[model samples]
Target: MKKIKIGIIGGTGGIGRWFAQYFQKEGLEVWVSGRRSGPDLPTMARECPVVIVSVPIAATLSVIEQIGPLMPEEALLTDFTSLKAEPVRAMLRASSCEVIGLHPLFGPEAKTLAGHNVVVCPARSRKWLPFVLDLFRKGRARIIETTPEKHDEWMAQVQVLNHLNTIAMGLALKRSGFQLAELLPVATPAFEAKVEWMKKIFGPNAGLYAQIITHNPFVEDVFENYQESLRELKKWIRRRDDEGLRKRIEQAGLFPAVRMKEE
Candidate 1:
C-alpha cells in the first residue's frame, strides 16, 4: 500500500507540529513548510496529494492566496484556522483544488483526543470526506460536520468570548492588585477553576487571542452582552434590590434550560 503524502504549511507552529507528528504516527509521509522563501515548500506541496495550512488566522488567507495556484490540481487542501469562513472563501476563490476547513476545538496542549471535537467544513469534493473522517477517527477525535457560517458563529462564542472573559479576569486582577498565588488558598472551587483557565489563556501568544476576537463578527455582540450583564449586576447590587437580583438569577437559570432543550 502506498502511504499518503501530506504537506503541512506553517508546520513549525504548535498545532502544525502536532499534526505533523499525528499524521506521521498514522503512517502518512509528512512535509512541513513555513513562509520563508525556499524550494522545499513548493517541492513538498507539489509532491503531496494533500496539503494542510495551519498558520495563524491573520496569515491564513494570505498564505492561501500564495499557495492556491501552486498546489497540484488533484491535491486536496485544508486549513486548521480557528475562523473558517474567510479562509474557506479565500481558498474557494483562489483555486480549483478541493478545499476544506478544519477547526480543532481543543488546544495543542491536549494530550488525548478522547473527548475532543474537530469541526469539518467540506468544500469542492465528496471524495476526500471519508479520508478526512478516518484521519480524525485515528486521532480519537469526534468529528462535527458544519457549514462555514455555523462554525464561525459557534467559534465566536467558544473561542472569542471565552478568551475575552479570561483576558478580562486577568486585567481585573491586575487592577485590584491581587496576586494569583496569594488567592489560591482563599479561592473557591469556581474561582480556582477560572484561574486555571486564565493561566492557559495568558500563557500563550497574546496575538492569537487578539486575532480570534477581532476576526470574528459575533464577538462584538458577545462583549456588549458581557458589559451589559456587568452593569445590570452592579445596578442590582447598588439598589439592594433582592427581588430584582432574584428575578435575574431565575431568568438566567431558565435561559440555559431553553438553550439546552434547543440544542
Candidate 2:
C-alpha cells in the first residue's frame, strides 16, 4: 500500500506547526518546509497529495503563485489564511487541483477543536471535498462552509474590527504617559481585563494582526464606520449630551444580532 503524504509550506511554527503535529498523530507522512529547510515547493507538489499553504498572511499569495502550477490535478490545494477571498481566487487561478480555502477560527494555542469553528470555502473542489471535510470532522471541529467572498466579508468585522479595537486601546494606553504597572494598580476590573486582553493579543502577534487589518478588502469600509462611530461619540462627549448618548447607546444595544447563548 502506498503511504499518504501531506506537505505544509510553512509548517515550522504557528498553526502550521499545530497541524503538522496533528497529522503526525494521524499516521500520515507529514513533510514540513521552512524558508531554509525541508522539502521545497516543487518536490512537495509532485509527491504530496494534499499541499497546504500555511505561511504568514503577507507571504501566502506569492507562495501559492510559486507552487500552484506544479501541483497534480488530483491533489488538493488549500490554505490556512484568515481572509479567504484573495487566497482562494489565487489558488483557483494558479492551480488545476481541487482548491479549498480553510480558516481555522482559533489560534495555535487551542488544545482541541471542541467548539471552535473551521470555516471551509470549497472553490473548484469536487474530487477532494470529502477528504478535506472528513479530516476536520475527525478533529471534532465545528465546520461552517461558505464562499470565499462571504468568509472575508464576515471576517472584516469579526477579525479586522476586533483587532482594530484592541490596537486602539493598546495605542491609547501607550500614549497616556503612564506605565502599565501604574495604570493596572488603579484600573477598574473591566478596564484591567481589556488591558490584559490587549496585551495578550497585541504584543507578540502584532504583525499577524496588522496583516489582518490591512489585507482585508473590506477594511476601508470598516475603518469608515469605526471613524463615524467615534465622531458621533466624540460629539456627544463634547456637548455633554447625556440623554443623546444614553439613547444612542440604548439603540445600539438593540442592534440586530442573534446573540449566542453563553457556553
Candidate 3:
C-alpha cells in the first residue's frame, strides 16, 4: 500500500523538521515548506491528505489564514503550536478541513517521543483523529486529550510561568554582575543544572520562548501573580519576619495541585 503523504508547513527546521523525520520513520511520505525553499504553501495544502502548520507562534495564524482556505474538505488541517486556542480557532474559521491542535510538550532536541507528552485538541476532526493519534502512540508518546482553551490555560502556567522564572534568574544573575567563572567554583548541583538547562532555552529556543510568553492570552494573570509573590517576599525580607517566611514556604510545600480532584 502507498503511504499517505504528509505536508508540513515551515517543516524545513526545528520541530517541523523533527516531525518530518518522525513521520518518515513511520513509513509516511513527508513534504515540507519554509520561507527559503521546498514546496509552496498552497501546493502543500492542496496535495497532502494531512497538512500541519508548524510555523513559529507569531506566524502560525498568518500561515493558517492564507493556506487554510486552500485545503480540501477531506484533508486534515492541524497545527503544532505551544498556545493552541488562537491557532485552532483560525484553522477552524479559514478551512473546511478537519482540525486538530497539537502541542508537543517537549522540544525538537528530544531524542524520541518515548515518555514525553503530546497534547491534542481535536477541534473539528472526526475521521483524521484516530490516524493522527495512532501515529503518536506508535512513537511512544503520551497523549493528552484536552480542549484548546483548557490547553492554553494550562500552558500559561506550564510554559509561561516556567520560562518567566528562568528568565528572572538570568536577569538576577546579570544584575548581580557575578561572573559565571566565579559562581561555577561554588555552584551547587541544582544551580549548575539549572544554568545548563537554561542555556538551551536562552540560546536556540530564545525566540520561541519569547513568543510563548507573549502570545498566550492567560499569561497576564500569571505575570500578575508572579509580581505579587515577589512583592510579598520583599515585604517579608524587609521586616525580617522569619515566621511569616516560614509559613509561606510551608504553604508552597502543600503541593495543592497534586491534591486537586481529577476531572
Highest-lDDT candidate = 3
Candidate 1 yields a Cα-based lDDT of 0.85
A best-first ranking of the candidates according to their TM-score comes to 3, 2, 1
TM-score of each: 0.91, 0.93, 0.94
Candidate No. with top TM-score: 3
> Candidate 2: deviation at residue 210, Å?
0.8
Model 2 Cα displacement at 61 (Å)?
1.3
The pairs that clash in candidate 3 are none
Q: Which runs in model 1 stand beyond 4 Å of their true positions?
A: 35-39, 254-263
Q: Which residue pairs clash within candidate 1? A: none
Instruction: For each candidate in the order shown, give its overall lDDT on alpha carbons.
Output: 0.85, 0.90, 0.92
Candidate 1 local lDDT, 1-263, one digit each (tens) = 99998888888777888888888988998888866833365686678888888888899888888888777777888999999889999988887888888988877788876679999999776678789989999878999999999999998778888899899989999899979889899999999899888877687677888898999978888889899989989999999999999888877875787767856
| Over 4 Å off, model 3 | 256-263
Return whichever of 1 and 2 wins on lDDT.
2
Query: Whole-model lDDT for model 3 versus the true structure?
Result: 0.92
Tell me the tens digit of each residue's lDDT in model 2 across 88-107: 99999999999999999998
